[model samples]
Target: MGKTAPPSIVVVGSGLAGFGVLRELRRLSPDAKLTMVTLENGHFYSKPALSTALAKGNTSETLVTSSAEKMIAQLKLDARIGREAESIDRAGKALCTTGGPIPYDRLILAMGAAAYRPAIEGDAAHRAISVNQLDHYAYFREQLPDQARVLIMGSGLVGTEFANDLITNHYQVVVVDILTLPLAQLVPPAVGESVRDALASEGVEWHLDRKVVAINYVGDRAGYVATLDDGSNIEADLVLSAVGLRPNVALAQEAGIDIGIGIKVNQYGQTSDPDVYAIGDCAEYQHGISAYVTPIMAAARGIAQSALGTPTEIRFPPLAVQVKTTLLPVNLLPPARNCVGEWHSVESDVDGDKHLFIDDRGFVRGYVLTRQKTEQRVEMDTKVGELA
Candidate 1:
């Protein structure tokens, strides 16, 4: 009898989830023929640096510690960097690319989300950018001059972080959003207000209840004049479209895979088709949400074990999404649904305080903290763990 050939696995995208699956798969099945494909050069690093760049005065190159070549050598896996997957032929079990088709027994899509930009008329709108990837951050950093005016279109987590960073970098920062409060949709109202105040004290401007209707170039200069719906206008050196993100689910949808807000997957990160799995921002898993990194990290081991044939049952816990911002001296952990609660604020010296949320049942489902009040994080974590 001939020796059975090892399984062949192909992973698309080189972000956290894709690389994570690749590493986990390698550990689970050493002999599996693995290949990774990415549209961008698969330089690996912690992506949270996108927001932290301004404070560090670091460019993308400074944040990216390893190149695709180095990752390939280190991980000992076949790599196809800077190549886009044109389509997937599931019947043929092959991925069609601009280069050629590559066959695989199993495929994983880790392609993340594209920044969402609302339809609005504007001149020099081409100057608007979303710093989602390292490349994008590098490009924007190079384009910025000292004391440049930056107008961000969202007051969400990403927008707030950028606002904090730009302030630290001495850039005049303005945040515009339809929501009356920054981070309203994420953190509770009180916590959101405190964060807004902190950023304001740092010289960040907030234009709540306003929207940009049009953007036009300011003469020949690399600038844009934004016309607000309120008949007010602001000229800015750059516009960052950080409103939100839409998952990359076109490939999965076209391949006849079930997709909702993202690629629908089971508890183990298995898609409708057992052989074709999804992870990261592209995957809507058992819990029905796929945005942050914590849940994705929790799903990695289960996905890997299943792909390698030594299947393991993994139950995912409700992971807390931590927002990294300098202005807000706190962390927020909200429940899954739009569950409401009353907040209790206790002052902790001058720099810190804890905001605890108690629901109708007197259960603490969420929490917000300042630097000094962060000591209760462990207590909140315990409650969250019990709830999970």
Candidate 2:
């Protein structure tokens, strides 16, 4: 009898999640038949680092840790770069892409989310750029004028980070958000205010409890006029949208896969189709979406191992999400949405603050560390009431 060929694996997307699984697979199985399909050129860069890098005078080119060719050679995997995975044909065990169909014994979908482009009224609303990838950030950097005035939408993690970087780089910045506090979803109100004041000291104009309702071009030089929901106008040379992300689930949904906030995945990273798995921003896991670094890595490990013949359970500790605003760094482990909790300050100083969320049951549900206090991460994680 002829020697049977090794099982073929196809990974859709080249974001952190895709890379995580790729690395795990390579580590576990040498000479594995692996193919990666991606929408963009698969150069590897820290997507999270982009917001903080501008202040250090780093460009997109410098931010990329490795080129696509370098990564491919390093991992010994074939890549179909600049191609979009259009659909999945489970019965045929193939992935249909813009280029063509590729057969796969196992498929991994890590099609990360697109930055949410909120609808605004006016001609230049379409020009509000959002950076969700290296390419997007590159374009944004190239489009800005020297020391340009920037209008940033959303005071969340991305927005706050960019504001700090831009302000530090001496760019005039104005930030608008519907939320009352900066990092409202993550840090406590007082901590948010502290970071807000810190960034404001570096020249970030805040328009909280408001939204940019409209935007229009002022002149031929890419200047903009943003109209708030309250009918106030702010002028800037560039407008950046950092609202959030909506997972790219259309391809999976059309293929009859279960969908939630992201593609539904089990503890083993298996989707509704056991042969297919998902992770990163596109996966709606049992604990919620696996969008951040730690969960993505854990889920990818489980997926890679299980698909390679080991059925391992995916587990990760309670997240300590970092808000990369340099003026005042924040580490947050916020309480669950349904938890009846109150944030109480455990420690405070002029430059830093720490707060713990104690639930109605008198259990430590979550914690926040800001500025100088963020250094105590290891010491603080022990205070969690339960291991989530």
Best by lDDT: 2
Tens digit per residue, CA lDDT, model 2, 219-276: 9565899999899999999999999999999998999999988999888889999999
Error at 10, model 1, angstroms = 0.5
What does candidate 1's lDDT look like per residue over 47-135, in tens digits?
77798787886778878888888889877888888788888898999988777998999898999888887888965666788989988
TM-score of each: 0.94, 0.96
Q: lDDT (0-100) at residue 158 of candidate 1?
A: 89
Candidate 2 Cα misplacement greater than 4 A, ranges: 1-4
Error of 1 at 221 (Å): 5.3
Point out where model 1 deviates above 4 Å: 220-222, 338-351
Mark the 10 consecutive residues where model 2 has the least summed lDDT. 379-388
Task: Let me know the TM-score candidate 2 reaches against the reference structure.
Answer: 0.96
RMSD (Å) of each candidate, 1 decimal:
1.9, 1.6
lDDT of 1 at 164: 88
